[model samples]
Target: MTVLHQLRRALLKPPSFTQAYGGTRTLTSPYHTENNSTAFIKPDDQNNRKTQGKWLTLPPFNTTINGASLGKNIAGIRQSTGEGNESTTTAIKWVMRCCPQLPRSLVQKLFRLRQVRRKPLESSNSVGDVHASECQVKRVSAKDSMRFGDTVYLPITVEASPTEKTECLCTEEELKFLHDLELYKDSAIIVINKPTGMPVQGGIGIKRSLDELAGTYMRYELSEAPRLVHRLDRDSSGILVLGRTQYSATVLHSIFREKTIGASNIDLKSEKRFLQRKYWALVIGSPRRPQGLISVPLGKVVMDDGRSERITVVENVSTTASQHAITEYRVLDSSFHGLTWLELSPLTGRKHQLRVHCAEVLGTPIVGDYKYGWQAHKKWNRIQIASSNLEHKIEVCNKSSLPFGLNLESGSIADKQPNLHLHCKKMVLPDVSSAIKQACISSSDYDFADIKSLKFDAPLPPHMQRSWDILSS
Candidate 1:
């Protein structure tokens, strides 16, 4: 029988194997063929199929109300839909809507309740933000519980979270790699070497990233768990930042938005439109020179008759253009030794900015970079660079020094070619709160160093890590 047929037969029988990696399905889970009962299959089983749909294409979101960039702070907001069933805050009911404009006061109030998380984004799901559309206000002054008139559709963002999650793929040995580089931090602005081949968020398998592994060392290391201020590609590795508090999230965001140029991360709060950024990459072939810049404006292109993601671009600005972007790059090193090593400084943060700039603009894409680059650039999907992670593996955990089952045997080697070598490099800013609070702003005042490292090697998947060792040697 065909594998599909055998699988289908098994699916029709009693206990099923098709459903295991498929994970559990929900009331909202779509049928294999969308609204068709004849084509029912779990996600994991669907993976083996021809993938009639797109690979890693983000699922459609209930985005009806993605609250992008707005902190929940408003006191009371009343959307102007004027419909009786409009969204409200107090209603337990939820209805899907797309990017609703919420009242300012209601937005502010959510920030107070801690109902929303400001940073260390829920990158698993591609869905961005959600705000309720309509909700009924209640006054339960003397009672423990309150009554409601009708279901108010308040703006709500629902991220994809697993009902049962697995331990992060970041293993004990991997943690050591990061620990050697100053990976752990109690204060904000923590750094670590991100491993490649894992999505930043939302999945069924044992994958890990800064967001997934943040909790592993969070409590023991800092007063607060750090949150990522930005995103890195699943395959790319390099420097990344985390925020410990909302205030830090705010300051760091401002710094990124304004692209502040000063060294003190807190000092650039007042600077307007100034950003300094640098990154490193190991590409497929030797570059023209060790250094140069690639400039282009990126534009979103649609594809598959609108079935899935299109090739994202960095198109130059047109005289009558609606969008424009520019990226600068310089090759730091190159070799017939196999590939090109480069340093990139992005002047802008457009979608797929760096990847597209590398593949299309400069013609030297980061090795293992998925979603962009040349059709044949299929090395591994892990970027040669590590995330802002800058620490080396610490020998903190010892198998011979451990108890029974936990004692482990290990083997490893370094990459012949560098992994995605991107690093946040450095950023500076000013302490804008007050002089009294400024004393805490010392650069050396960081807390957790578990993620910190002295060396930059990450534990790769067996095959890739092996390849790296062979190449580097």
Candidate 2:
């Protein structure tokens, strides 16, 4: 036959175990068909044809191997390889490369298992043998077998533990109240319209709080009871978020701290914020400008009475334990009764930020805010008495020590005290539906369809509603 024809026949011939590695012994694999076998050719093996051992593929098995099952197989392989002096790390690497579906957990498990198995064996072995075994295991762990860079291919079937699930001890009435207060609910988060006088978290004298109520009442069929992601003042009524899972809490907390609202002129619009909180307040007066931004630094100050602490605008920005607080306000409506309905949006979440800004910066204090607005009200009353005619000063009584219009007879008291008029009216949160869906795709416990975008508005509380009604009338 011609040399060209012989070369052509050699090229066309199907690859056999003997043809590939000049051997009669065959390496069997389940992936192979009757006609063809997959060959793994190592660069070192190609050069050193005289090597004693041939690369062996995994034995054929009837059952399919998943991530956890593969972990067991890897443990066995690592244990066996550690016993022998031969370098099987290259073979394990080839197996991992070929079967990309194997999980990274398997690799870690293999190392851990090998170390554990080697410990007992090494205790009884000669010093030389223990040293050799340690060298081999360390070499495999350091360089060849454990390099699973970034991606991890875990099986869709994850084991769910019964211990992970939790139950709450709340009454039926509390559950109903929670249901009524709910603004939004999903697999990941629950947003509730918290009422004034209810603390977000428990304090020294606070017997009940939104957190306790949430733990009791918001236990929708989840592995654990929902947890609060952020806090609102005890007197501030508004939208509050609770994470249904630890993962959700972590994610939401990070998002709230990092994200921003409304796009800037720069490319910052592309990086959207996760949380947007808008508040409504009935202030005693209007701002000089109809709408404006307040960028002030605020710090905590202890009053002379030593019973309470309040946040005030810092004059000396250079030296103080102060944080930058920014708030945007717009006059929604104004009344002849010396009250203005203002929509306040805070860029930074400082304690009593909105109240301090209105009282100090804008020369307008929020109505029903005793801490900030009470002093302003007394001053205004004195000014009015001095300026007004005798007809206006006809009736004045100190029957109750409370502020002029804050008598119990007035229907403005929501709880025991005259409630703060500030309300968290609206909140905009990022849509985490896709993430929830992905997380729940393999989970039979949670229904993925229940997860959705978090955008909700809470109705004004009773006191604020009453004040609004009076102002509108």
Q: lDDT per residue, candidate 1, 30-118, as tens digits?
A: 21221111111224654544422111111222211111111111101122222221112221111111111222233333333322211
Supply the TM-score for candidate 1.
Answer: 0.45
Could you tell me the lDDT of residue 109 within candidate 1? 36
Candidate 1 residue runs with Cα over 4 Å from true position: 1-181, 184-186, 203-209, 221-224, 260-275, 285-290, 305-307, 314-323, 376-436, 439-473
Clashing pairs in 2: 260-273
Candidate 2, residue 185: lDDT: 76
- Please count the clashing residue pairs in each candidate, in the order shown: 110, 1
Give the alpha-carbon lDDT of every model: 0.38, 0.53
Q: After superposition, how far is residue 192 of candidate 1 from its true place, in Å?
A: 2.2
Model 1 / residue 434 / CA error / Å: 9.4
Each candidate's TM vs. the true structure?
0.45, 0.55
Candidate 2 per-residue lDDT over residues 297-408, each given as its tens digit: 8999999999989999999978878888888888999877667889998877778889999999998987768888788666543212222333332234343543211232
lDDT of 1: 0.38
